[model samples]
Target chain A: MTAWKEIDQHVKVWMNYARKLILAQIKTDVQVSTKSGPNDLVTNVDKEIEEYYVKQIKLFFPNSLILGEEGHKDSGMLKHQGYFWVIDPIDGTMNFVKEQENFASMIAIYYNGKPLLGYIYDVMKDKLFWGGPACQAVYCNNEKLNSPANLSLKDGLFGASCPMVLRNYRGINEVISKSSGARIVGSAGIEFINVMSGKLCAYLSFLRPWDYLPGKILAETLGLIVKTIDGEPVNVLSSTDVLVATDNAQSEIFKIINNY
Target chain B: MTAWKEIDQHVKVWMNYARKLILAQIKTDVQVSTKSGPNDLVTNVDKEIEEYYVKQIKLFFPNSLILGEEGHKDSGMLKHQGYFWVIDPIDGTMNFVKEQENFASMIAIYYNGKPLLGYIYDVMKDKLFWGGPACQAVYCNNEKLNSPANLSLKDGLFGASCPMVLRNYRGINEVISKSSGARIVGSAGIEFINVMSGKLCAYLSFLRPWDYLPGKILAETLGLIVKTIDGEPVNVLSSTDVLVATDNAQSEIFKIINNY
Candidate 1:
């Protein structure tokens, strides 16, 4: 595997650049429109930011396959390649357009479909979480990161979508309710960061590929599980109920989700 | 009545000072302890910010009664006081502590228990929603804000306690389903801003006095309904299931809530 230290440096450059563009492009008189429903939103800022990140990827690493929200790129599928970057230029766009905070710019680099680097920047706060390369995965703002404990769901908090709490989703409610508790931050990148830092034992949300990839790379590198809620291995090219967690958390969570 | 221009100056001066002290006190490693439950968190930042605002209030207007979160306040219930201030120095403390974002600073000032001035500041975005004292009140940042349409419950979105979306919570689910959709921003001040701005037709949440006062002032100023789900007027010093909405939205919401 390539040294994550070198890759993190390169990814940070692109992440920070997109962060600047995103902030600059955010309109006070934002053009707000519903996506799936009213809860889900896509502002011009979201689409523009995603496009900006895709542009940067093609310029810096022309051969790198790009996967992004807003259909900014079409990597088609994960392939053994020199480099592939997954980007969610503005994760939590509703929060960005409405509240204007708690959103992030996320990107991940994969070398031959294995983790090489990951970065999720809290644009407003100027803090970034990044790492990959499982043997010595890291997570932080240009600081060292320790791999989280292999905690079970019962031992820690979980971050997830609201449907899971209402038992509207499959085995999620049972699996999640049995945990210490749940925290829904409404962004995959933030939830993914929570799992990597041990703030959360697991995060289960119906997320698109761009939303899941950066976090998935970061989670897997931190020795955490990144799988579907049904315990199926994730299909990287499509959206899924992605569950990212520590190994012990995954096993314990699987028990609760097994009914599905 | 004092002009909004005059009131804005005073409210903003004090808020900026409070925000500065708050900014200095809060950081990633601040001491955090649980409150109410594991899900609820309180940091030293909360206490310090409220105290600073209290001190500023004493210096600026000695006669104004003051009510503040963090238990540092000493003022009676909303009465026919000549001048008074209600402050939630740091709203969304859970988000502030865990996510370190999405929290806000809020204040509602009144003369004789009538809405005189209101403010809800998204600290990260540095945008303040402020206005009051009128046959009709309005909100804005440095510029003027045009009120969004008084859409019905079936037409606009709602923000509320996630619990309201499920288990009926007084038929909130049906009321919400009638709406285009729902969003849970996890901050009363922010949620209330959405309601006042008409981005959401209604907001219902379990709230303490501190959470209600500022939003209550703003919602009422916008020709909207502000009350408990049971149709009781919110007591300025009580815990309640507070609801804020336009008149039409309120009617629709209450009817459904009554049925459930």
Candidate 2:
């Protein structure tokens, strides 16, 4: 196998192992605590999963840079000219604690600032959607996903952030009105999966690097659009409002956002 | 077995059969069309499922009055003193056509204006959550579900209607802000499942009789509150805004709506 193929194999194995750990933790009393606020929660499982990923990365590729949600941040690592991995130990921590479903674990790897492999695992469902530009096709497990039809905003469901929808931020209300309906799964990764699987036309939310990177990589590779509400490239380092959408939907949304 | 038990067994078998029919239709070319507007979608599969349910109900209970989402509407059936069946063969028709995952099939049986049983089957997930006050316990598949802890609005996720959240109607914005966060699944049956399964503390939406009745029956059996935004009892014969919530969350949400 080629170098990328080998890396893919190793990462897949690590993800499955991590899934086991996360599932095991749920069976026990999960140690939960507040972070920035009461709603912003972090559990012992999140930390353990992140630490597990960091340890594996260090052992396999010592020179690699890691940016993880639960710590393990190498500032300015996006500029690093080597293996760089972005990990969200558990996306939608609230959903994990509350629903125990609709949450995901994601990892995005970049080689010398270029997209490599991207993986987002719906841990409970045991469905791993992973691929990148290198593979030339995204796969939900072994079946490669076809590029979704370029559905317009009016033709598909639009995923929105609850706060954005509530506040009508950036003409989101107008955008939602144009779509068939709005859905909020409260997990960026799962929402991204919805779009990637041709289930949703677009997904918009304020997201961090680790939250958006894996989905962004997989989405863009499938001929989807990932950018800011203003139609600008998203900075990999900053937390900002991001929109990942189908081509036709992106154009339709831009019309609404620009009017706002 | 008791009369209710026999009915439950037969209903479970019918639901599994309907699930098979629906899944089979998805594998073929689904016939889709609009109702009311382009956003309000219905499919041949939806009609077929409803027809199947009606046939089963009529065969088993010949005197039953059926109120179904597709076509079978026995007017003023809620006042009927015999078996009254409410069938939403496919709830979340939009989701069924667009996502094929989040939608559900629901059947609510009432006898002499009293709820006897409710069944909501998440078709794709193959999970059947069915029960009533008659059963004294709701069961997801074979496992009995406990009544969720009465979480306050600040302690759990709240499910909201897109339009309500968008317009901030009825002070939904204030109610959502008080909750840990907001979620919109676009399927009343599924949202009710979330609440029934202790995943969401509350779910609010504007729904017709078929849209809300099954969930209402099931949710009330679990000691959850189901009422209008004004804290009034929900009528079984009309379309209105409904709220199904945990006891504590119901009180908290009523305070927000009252203040509004």
Candidate 3:
């Protein structure tokens, strides 16, 4: 068995370093570029942060396979026999470029295809929600977080993607209308933190691997459900329509999605 | 004209006191009640804060007229001959009860039927966005804020009430689709802050006097437009469909709303 405590300490140190670098760039001119379209944005800072994590992981765990959002996918490196790491360098790149707030840095670790550890760092707020299967508990900064209540669709607020709601994709409008309200924070990691902290009951969006990986691990550790909208297991290797919610909310949401 | 600097100092002191009272109640259980529906919430803290402000206002400016969200409307007091204070003790009460963040305490002061000063206190973050016609500039905490860019509707994000979007009220869905995206922060004060800070280009909602008064004062001072959706003036004494936005965004949004 790995020394999980020692690994946690090391990861926290690197994450704090990453936080410093992120804070230093806020309000300064950042070179932003389009990814798929004008709405999809990526920045030089995102690439720099991803490269920093890849270098740190290789230095500390030399044999680890790495997957990053900023084009670091090397299928040949995936032996699937040892440790693996997924990094999102900067989640909510649009919010990062626009508001300079509400974005996060995320990392998830796996061992032999099993989830091991995850971290979602809200760099602007100086909060790191981290934990994993090995620890069996999630911590926000220093406080161990309690699992949110298993609220039904009517009992709590919902978060969803704007495009999905505007288009009423897969009946998301029906799902959101039943809740207290809908919130669109524009950051999947921040939305996940809302679910984990009980601020939101569920977050539904079509997300890429690096966008949902760390949030999924951290959320699942707190007794929440993280799965595809179709009630299928998340592939972890491909993009999917994702739903992260408390148990009761997931059951309620599943009924709506299935009916559609 | 009215010892504006001295009054500003006094208001800041009272606002800080109110902030302390609010922070103390967070994370602790408080009685919650419905105002119009389950989605429209009011808490004991809301009532307490409103009463606290009323008491302070009476003690300091004994002759001032007060209009508050939690039933402090006395039409007889509104002769438009002296000082009038409008207050929304907790602008986003649902958020305050559910998330304990994103809510704001708002106050607007009018002298002889003209707006004199306004304050929007983001209680949790300790950010007070305050200014007035007398001051000629708004301030976030201590620094004077710059006016946000006059971006067109297609250039920035938009915020709106959930029901409005779900029902496509006034063609908001079409307007939102034309923007970069939609964001729903659930607080008019926070949404106004976003527009003033250039994070969101526009915010649309049906708002009461206390809900939009302070934000309107600050936003107008920053050169943003605050008007009824029908191109009429917003009455300071009643509820109306209000739209607050940058100049360019307002022109674009007006076309859509008028067409609908």
Candidate 4:
């Protein structure tokens, strides 16, 4: 228990530190460029923030394994004991570089393949969603999470990847046309906040491990569905097309996405 | 000039009033229900606010036509000599009902088929994007508008409806996959904020007049392309697929969508 508390405290400190550094860079003229194409933007802030977290991780917890989005440590090993830290120093890099609002910093800690901690920080909003399976508390900043009002896709909003909608993403169009309507917030971190806050009925994305790990921890803690679209158990180490929804909402989404 | 200034003042005053009332309704346990489905939602606040805006519009400008999301007015005839007020009293209704954070109240005024005024109030953020073709001054709260850095889709981020990319609405997927990245914030008003702030290269959605009307006014004022998917003028009284982008970005998007 003390170790858990220690880990949480240590992580909290690092997150605040990273947040300060990142926002400072964003407020300045940081050099920006493209990765895959015109829309996929990356900035020096993403790299600098990640390196800051990694340096702290190595110094305080040398035994812990690190996996990050910037391709810093490609040791290519997910299986670890003691502790493993999966980090996206800037989870929504495009949003961070572009919107400067919706992006997040995500970090998840696992012990012996058991989820222990997750944190998704929205810098612009100044909100932090933090928790784990072992901890009974999932918090937004200092406030405890109130379980989202029970709602289904037909009754609530869906957070979806825009590209998926056009490809007939297995009834996604139908989902939007049928639902109150669809909303597309650009960042996974913001989407996770919406889900945990019970704003969106569900959020599904072509997501990577670091992109979702922290959100998965928070969502699961708040009693939301965190799984692959096919209803398979999520393998946190891989990038999976995942859905995070309320229990009742999951069934409705499943019926829709499957038919699409 | 007197008429424009008076109406602009009226817009700002009523926008603030609507913002407060909407926020108050959010804090209250207002009634909420599904619209088309769970993804689509409506609260009593959305309805009341629209009614309130219409009342204000008809009171001040008795002959002005009104278009709203809650089916408030008839925009069938937007003739010359008077004004047409396009209002989405509470944009991002789902967010207002569910998360209560990401919504906005948008208003746009046009006269003789030309944009006269535009305002998108980020109630939660307390920031307002306001200007018009006649005003030629875009302000967020009190800050004056400056020409944004000219960036292409490849050099910037984009906002699209989540489901639009999957089924190939104008080859959005190929365009998105090749660009910096995509973000889908569920609200057109909010997405319009991204474009006006110069964060997004573009935002494309199948939107009605109320949905894209204010957005078109602001996007145009900010030197962004807000047009129909095909090469035609956006009919402010009709629901259509609208694209708001930078010049070069729009050309790239046009090429891609046309190809698809």
Candidate 5:
């Protein structure tokens, strides 16, 4: 098998193992803690899942570097050659803690600074959306996903960040008013799935590296556009307002944002 | 069996049958149509599901009056001193047509102008949230659901209508800013499930009787508050801005709306 195919198999196995760890503890009492502020929650499951990924990556591929959501970081991984992985084990910690649904676990792999493989596991739904430029197509489990319809903003539901919509940040409210409607599922991974699946035309939010990268790789592979709100390329390591959308919606949203 | 118990059983069986009809047709080409506007969608599956429920209700309880989302209405049934049923063959028509997920089928039963039973089946998830004052407890399938904690405005997530949040209707933006965050799922039945399950502290939307009745019945039965934004009694036969929330969140939201 090709190296990419072998790595893909390993990542899927690790993700499913991480999924079990999360589901096993979800029904029991979750040890909840706050990060940054009261509303920014992180549970014990998130930490354990991330730790498990970090350990597995190290065990399976000793040369690979890692960046993880729960404080696992390799300071100079980006500069190194070979495998570099980004892990968001239990994205949407708030949803995981409160609803135990609508959350996901994700991994994005880059080889020598090129996007290679991505995996996003909708933990509750048990749907794994994985693939990248290397694999040449994205999949929701065993089914390969066709590119979503090229819908404009007005033709599809828009997914907005709560803070952006609430504060009318950059005139997002104006943009929302022009769409069919808005949906805020509160999990970036789920929102990404919506855009990739043609359920939503676009999703815009302030997202950190781990929050946006896996979805970015998969979405772009499916012929969707992933970029900064300003229509510039997104910095893979920085937190910024990222927008993943159909080509038509990206142009429409850019028009609104530039007008704002 | 008691009359109410028998009715509940019948409704459950009928809802499951409706669910099957919906699932079977969901993957095939859905015959799409519209009502009121382009965004207001209805599919042949929706019509089929409602027709099935209406037929069953008429067959089993010949005296029961029916009001359905897809043009099945029995005028003056509110005045009848017997069972009155409201059916939304498929809630979240847009979601159903676009995402094929996050939508539901619902039924609300009233006796002598008083709410009796409510069932909201999340078709894609295969989970039915059903119960009423008659049952004395709410259930997700077979397990009984406990009342969600009475979280205050800042302690929980807030669910808002896209238009309401966009227009800042009655200062809903202010209320959203005070909560942990805002979520807009665009389906009243799904949002009601979130609030009833304590995933959200509140959900506010302008809904028709068929849109809100089933959820209002289930929510109120679970020790949650269901009322108009102004704290007035929700008229069961009219369209209005309804709020379903925990006690503390309701009071906090009412204060904000009143000030607005």
Candidate 6:
């Protein structure tokens, strides 16, 4: 078995270094460009940050497989029997370029296709929520995090993707209305963080691996359900509609989505 | 003139005191109740804070008219007003009771029907965005704030009340889709703050005087528009649909609403 505890310690150090670099770039002018469209943005910083994390991963775990949002694609490595890192350098690139807040950097690690460690860093707030099976505990900064209350849809707010809500995809509007309200912070990692913190009962979005991987690891560790909208396990190698919620919330959301 | 500068200075002191009281109550168990419906919330803190402000206003400006959300209804005072203070002790009371953040405490001073000064205190962040015509300046905390960029609807995010958007009132969904995205922070004061800070292009919602008063004063001072959807002035004593936005965004939003 891998020394997962030792790996967690090293990852924490790397993430701290990554945080410093991200903060340093916040004040400087960002070079922004669109990927899928104008609404879908990617920044030079995203590329640089992803490259930085990949470099760190490669240096520390030379044979590790890497899948990153900023165009690092080696899917074949996922099939290898070794450590694998899924990283989203800057999760909310649009927010990063526009609001300069609500964005996050996330990293998830797996060993031989089993979850190992996860880190979701709220860059602006300087909060690092990290943990996994190996660490045996979920934490925000140094404080251990409790499992979110199993709030029903009516008892808490929901986080949703704009396109999903605007289009009312799979009855998102109805699901949202059943909740206290909806929040759209435009960051998958931040949305996941909100779910884990009990600030949001659930977050549903069509997300890629890098977008949801770290959140999935951290959230599941805290006893929150992270799965596809169809109540299936999330396939961390493709884009899919994902739901991260407490037990009651997940069940309630699934019933709504299924009925629709 | 009403010695507006002196009044501003004193209001700041009262606001600081109010801030301290609000912060102190944040950690205590809150007594929550509903108004209008379950979605429209009120807390003991809201009542206490509004009463606190009213007491200060009555003590400091003995002849001032006071209209507050927490049942300090004295429309008669407006008629004989030397200074009218419109206050919403906790503008996003639901958010306050649920999230404990994003809500604001606001006070707007109008002298004989002319806007004089406004204060929107983001109690948690400790940011007091205040100023008006008499001051000839707007500020977030101590720093003088600049007018937001004249961003068009397509260039920035739009803030809308949930019901308005869910029902597509005034074609809000279309208007929001034209913007970068939609944000629903559930607090009119925070939405106005976002527009002034260039974080959101506009905020549209049905608001009473206490809800939109402070935001209107500060937004206008920053050269942003605060008016009704049909381009009429907002009536200070009644609930109406209010739009707060920069020049280009306001015009673009108007065009979309008018077309629909």
**Candidate of highest DockQ:** 2
Residue lDDT tens for model 3, B1-260 = 35888878878888888888888887775789998898999888889888998898888787788999998875654566778999999999989988989999999999988999999999988899999898899999999999999988988989888889899998899999899889999999999998999999999999988989999999999999999887678988879999999999998999988887
- How many Å off is the CA of B27 in candidate 1? 3.3
| Model 3 agreement with the true structure over A202-231: per-residue lDDT tens digits | 999999988999999999999999999877
Kindly give the stretch of ten consecutive residues in candidate 1 chain B with the minimal lDDT sum. B160-169
What is the Cα-based lDDT of residue A41 in candidate 6?
A: 89
Q: What's the TM-score of chain A alone for every prediction?
A: 0.88, 0.97, 0.97, 0.94, 0.98, 0.96
Error of 5 at A21 (Å): 0.8
The candidate, 4 or 6, that scores higher on TM-score is: 6
Which model is ahead, 4 or 5, in terms of lDDT?
5
Clashing pairs in 5: none
First chain of candidate 4, TM-score: 0.94
Clashes of each: 0, 0, 0, 45, 0, 0
Q: Supply the global lDDT for candidate 2.
A: 0.91
lDDT of candidate 6 over B1-260, digit per residue (tens):
55887888888888888778778887696888888876778888888888988998899888888888999977675566588889888898877876778899899998878888999999888899999998899988889998889988888988878888777898888998888888778899998898898888888999888889888888988888989999898887778999999899888888888999
What lDDT does candidate 1 reach at residue A245? 87
Tens digits of per-residue lDDT for model 1 on B1-260?
A: 45656667877987787677667766644677777776566777777778878887788677778888777666564664577778888898766754455679998887877777788998867778877654256556766666656778766767757545445577676675677555666789988877776667888888887888877877776678898888888877788899998888888888887877
Task: Please state every model's RMSD to the true fold in angstroms.
Answer: 4.8, 1.5, 1.5, 3.3, 1.7, 1.5
What's the DockQ for every one of the candidates? 0.16, 0.86, 0.82, 0.50, 0.78, 0.66
By lDDT: ranked, best first:
5, 2, 3, 6, 4, 1
lDDT of 4 by residue, B154-225 (tens): 776778775575455667777777566676677889888887788877888888888888878877887877
Which regions of candidate 2 deviate over 4 angstroms? Answer: none
What is candidate 2's lDDT per residue for B74-132, written digit by digit as tens? 87686787889999999999988899888999999998889999999999999999999
